[model samples]
Target: MNHFTICASKNDTHDIEEGILDTLAQGFVVEKNDSSYLLKSKGLFKRHQGAIHVIADNTDPDYFAKNMPGMMSFYHNIPFEDEQLKELVMIQISVFNTVIAVEMDKEITDEQMQLLIKLLSSIGGVGFLPDGTLLDQQGLVIVYPNGESGPSNFRPHACTKMINVQEATSAQGEARKNNTIAFLVEKGIPYVASLPQLPSVEDCAFKRQEDIAKRAVALLIAIQFACDVAQSGNIEDSREFFLNMLHKYNVQQFLTDNEKSFLQAQYPDAQYPDAQEAVSIAWQYEAYWTLIWALGFVETLEFPDDVCDCDYAIQVVSSCETFEQFYAQIAMRSKEEILDEADKIYRLHWACVNSRINGQAAPLALNESVVMERRRALFWMIGYRNEQWDTMSMDT
Candidate 1:
């Protein structure tokens, strides 16, 4: 059976009217594979159904048809939001322009232009017209006006400067050029061009800067621990005196009032948030990468805390496996301690990080899983941190 008859309305005394209303209400049921709404039946009422249709997909191609409004409402009724989406559009443009610039004078297709407009519309404000004309926030005339025929000109590159209102188009272009040079400088770590060696990680320029910053944070935290040990006065007057001496020498200018307070008051029990701690880390990172070209070695061999008690991996170790075990295995230290003992741990941990960076660190007792576990443990111990992509300038 291709189709069936039905009553269109119950109130209508006329059989024809009743059948018409029922048939419309019963609509069509689309097959799952078609990825379309309504199975649109064929037969007697087909002509009438087409005539009375109110939400036909052909009416507005702009409206995405895959998931109808009713279907979307089931998930959430709200529409899209966010300014980052606009930035992403710009990033995409950059990627496109770079490719085109290298691939010769290849122009974006009509479909590409439509997609760009759709993406820009989702981001809100000014967008490109079907013919590549730019629209302002009020959807009025902008730098490149639109006409009935289409856009007057095609300058996809201009879109990059439109979002960055802070900088003029020329300024933005110049900034991008500078950023590219800076990126190169970062990659050529231990040197800006041929001079001024930059002590940073071995990778892209951004990665190098990030690695230096983390090392700086690690050194700062270790300095704080030394300060704590000295303040306790239990170790030795000489030990306390030496710690204070190093503190004055290394971390004075970089330490904020709040950080100093934390050192004086919170010491071991204190909880430090990520971004705030990153500030201090950034300070040391700047100095370390700039001044110190040659870095020391760091080694770590993460093992279960109870590894000493048993030859096999301990069940308790599954819950509280620590990196100190790795340090102990290599450093010849039998005892274990918290991360606060960074001064004592740095010798081994530094060796681990340095060796890994230099490809000098060799695999120990464990397989890849154990290696990954230990790497994570060492990350915290070495104050490993990821760089924010948005923060660093991109090569224009």
Candidate 2:
């Protein structure tokens, strides 16, 4: 059987090709043929096929993009003493923008496989097997951006397990839940086992409490303005009211792209928002709620089985006149507290996504939109991936 490996890289095609040649030079005589390479073993007897075809291109790896969250979740389960390295791998995986295809005419030997992995890894590449296993250049070692690597115990076909929450019998449902929890726990991710658990405050890297408070206030003003303009059909008075609030809070610089776009669409000659746009703008309330919770405005974020109370949400922000007053009322939760919630929501969000992919109702009464928006807020609060507010990825 022919063997194939898909690799993702930050390097261009030429550099990756050179890397392949350099890596294989010790074991084989390599000849470059355009994008392909031909190899002959230096040993007396060849162990496998002598020819390899490579195709490198500048394109997003669709499989990686679609399954990234699941892959990262898998990696996150692996234990790493260096939290920074763990995070670095996540960030590097998120930004890989190129793909390389390595093909052999026959199944590769174990030795040949290691060579291929080494070549890819030398160029800061990630490998994906046909069975959905992700690997570093050193076979199973998870490589860091700075050339350090850690052993990985990730198993193949782990991502293919699926459960239909609505169809299973009570016994089967319990089994599935137990299996899922066990799997996560064995992988060193215990946060998903129960109600969200906070890490120690010392372990968290949090934005300044005051900064979080300011952001919450700014989001509140922007989202509320959007709600009003949507309710008033984008009238001049509504625009004036929003502008006045922005001036009052001096939060113009903090508006997210979505908020700015919604406002811009309401310019004097612009059209009123369509139903989709209006709903999107309104849903920012959930994100706003999460920020307030982080800022200690909300007592606790109840399970997201329902949308947050709009009237109560409005009351929370309106109670404070200025940003300073809102900051004053803030008893900002510890970074550990917010991250714990974020981690729990992440797993819950994954279940929701898994259900959708399987054509079933969202499991555990999860409101998919609420879960997603809440995650978006929590992720932003913790600066997950250091992404901008509008571009932040809520990878399950």
Candidate 3:
């Protein structure tokens, strides 16, 4: 049963909600039997008990505003407050338009027009609930204007994706489009798209921008660590340095401030709370930051010309079991290149993160003394300090 459920069919509830969470939350990449990466959210696609009663499209500007109150009441068993439900609706509306909406050529209703707005805003993070699959091609349900019956979404490739929004009496077309967008917006949930370099992950342009932000946050945290320690004159463990900086500068706070300025200066159409939530998650994702850095996944930190051998991967980075193994992937470059990377804390900071998150530098986990000694060997392969790290751009 869902940990939060009180349903009598407790087994059914568990089979639904947890199944979705277990599959989609946090991790995005899943290795296939073929050793390839599946960037799709497999969990959302998993078979489950929860049901989404796809409702009819509505056109009233008040359609979503109206029905949401009903859904809010109906899904009481789902345990979301009205405001939270409203926020989800807003996020969904802002992400994709009339998700799973069908195309109908009819007089455009206020609702259909409203739906077009949502579809245009939909990006990588939008998807159907429970099994977050594609709602529709480009994740939209097209409602064409009346007297234009078979246009099929009005877009270039929507021909194959076309489906009539609702069967109208050559008359009720407008009502249907509004109802459709409003319906999907009400029921649809926010979905964070899976990882990169996979067909399942759409909106490559947006994802690229997001990945840049994630990497920059990681580097910023590391730099803050060194800068903080240098200022206070402490040479303790990098863990202490990390905590101190988090406390002193409150990384989350600064990120919120910067993000606000960014949104205001650029992305005039973008929403705020959503942007804030994303950065907030990245702020605490120290492990990911470290992983991207050591593995050279973040382009900004990549050595100018194979300067650091961190490019090779023996196994999927996420599955690696040892910190030393992660360190070994990136052998040091020349003396100048090595210094280009940064100082002792630079190496030490990552080492500690790898060890703490995956037990890389620790001896206790190995049990075998030889294995422990071997880890110590790999840990030191990439020398201390890398000035090269500081040169990367963080403009995203």
CA lDDT, every model vs. true structure: 0.28, 0.63, 0.28
lDDT tens readout by residue for model 2, 1-396: 345454453434557667867888877788877756777767677544466554432243345546654555555555556666666665555444455566565566777777877776676556766544557555675543333454764222111111111122344334445554664466443332322222233433456776666677677776776676667564566767876887686777777777777665644366565556666767878988998888777898987879998888878767877777766787878765676677667777776765665566775577989988898888777665465777666544
- The regions of model 2 sitting more than 4 angstroms off are 1-5, 8-15, 18-63, 69-205, 229-232, 265-270, 273-275
Q: Pick the candidate with the highest lDDT.
A: 2
> What are the per-residue Cα lDDT tens digits for candidate 3 across 219-268?
34543433433343332444355545344433334333443333223222
TM-score of each: 0.23, 0.59, 0.18
| Candidate 3 off by > 4 Å | 1-96, 99-218, 222-282, 290-396
Report lDDT (Cα) of residue 251, candidate 3.
36
Question: On residues 1-396, what C-alpha lDDT tens digit does candidate 1 reach at each position?
Answer: 111111010111233223223432343222222222222333354221212111222333233222222221211211213223333223323222100000101243343234333323332334433333334323333332212222223222333322332222344334433443464355431111111111122211222323333333334343334433434433333334533633543434444455444344432333333344434333332222221121221222233121222112222112222323322222222111212122222222222333343454322322222222233323333333332311211111
Candidate achieving the largest TM-score: 2
Ranked candidates (TM-score, high to low): 2, 1, 3
